[model samples]
Target: MPLCLDPNGNRCSYWPQDAHFVWEKNGQKIETCVSEQTHVLADGRVHVLTWIKDAVVQDSQYCCLVSSKAGNKMSTSYISVEGSNNQDSWSRGFASWKSIISEHDKLMTNWKKTWESCNKKDIV
Candidate 1:
């Protein structure tokens, strides 16, 4: 899976190379299968693409967070394999509330860290 971000806010030419990013799966930080790339479009938008390679095909949630002086933003995506076992799918929906809450808490904590790092400046 791949996530893309446009760091430009009201300022069209702003390029936030110091932006911070974190990727999570099922409320936990992803420690592997992650890579990132940045691109500058002709229209001056700074496009960032983060990819999660070799991910297992399953019903799971993923989140992407980016923080910079420009702003902080988070995006979530749920991946469900098509034609999965009906019983398994039903069970997942029935027991997903706790998982959702846990994920939310983890995301907030990680976002706070990313925000702090992205906003930190030299003490000079």
Candidate 2:
């Protein structure tokens, strides 16, 4: 049996077809063979439609663990500059959001790479 994502946003069952499974992103569906349909939490992350009942049951603890791991992997650098003139300070403040966004993008890229590496498997 193989686990599949539900395409229609409904509950479904999943069975392990082999030693490997597919990686589905958010807003995507997977089909599986498990009889009970429940929300799935994977790797301490909450998934919208997960077939693993245990994943749903342990979501809270898993979520905390995941958050801690994410926090550990993130690096933040903040620089505060006091300008002699108001205009200079205003300009620096306005540009701060861009730096924040760039940092977020870096974190996202790193997380994606980590996920891909962990989920790599050969299907027979």
Candidate 3:
């Protein structure tokens, strides 16, 4: 299930300006890509959306914190570059032990191949 949900137990469709949405990338706060409008919802909640421009430059872990009079909610997402080699793995900041082990295994395999190639002896 998604971290943020509406009273009907559905993913939040429209975020309100009153519910300030703070965005972060790789655990650090991001200040850019903030745009606001004068539109307001029927419930008197101003619609708010946070967009990140050119976000696919690199793999990253992103988080959104929504604070309102009711309570505070947080949502996190791992975004990988479209053509990244390790797209199957989590973002660098949110790497799991599984990915680490996989990377270690790949390195070991490469090292073993190099060692075998270097130590090969020519037969008469």
Question: TM-score for model 3?
Answer: 0.43
Number of clashes found in candidate 2: 17
Q: Write the per-residue lDDT of candidate 2 for residues 1-124, one digit (tens) a residue.
A: 2244455543343322232223222323334442333344443322333232333211122111112212322222222334434766667877997899999999999998887877785322
Task: List the candidate numbers ranked by lDDT, top first.
Answer: 1, 3, 2
TM-score of each: 0.52, 0.26, 0.43
State the lDDT of candidate 1 residue by residue for 1-124, as single tens digits: 2333444434444556557778898899986888887676767676777878655566788898988788889999988877554767778876897799899999999998887877785322
Model 3: per-residue Cα lDDT at residue 98: 67
Write the number of the candidate with greater TM-score, choosing between 1 and 3: 1
Off by over 4 Å in 2: 1-86, 122-124
lDDT winner = 1
Error in Å for residue 116 of model 2: 1.3
| Model 2 TM-score, all chains together | 0.26
Please identify which of the two predictions, 1 or 3, would achieve the higher lDDT against the true structure: 1
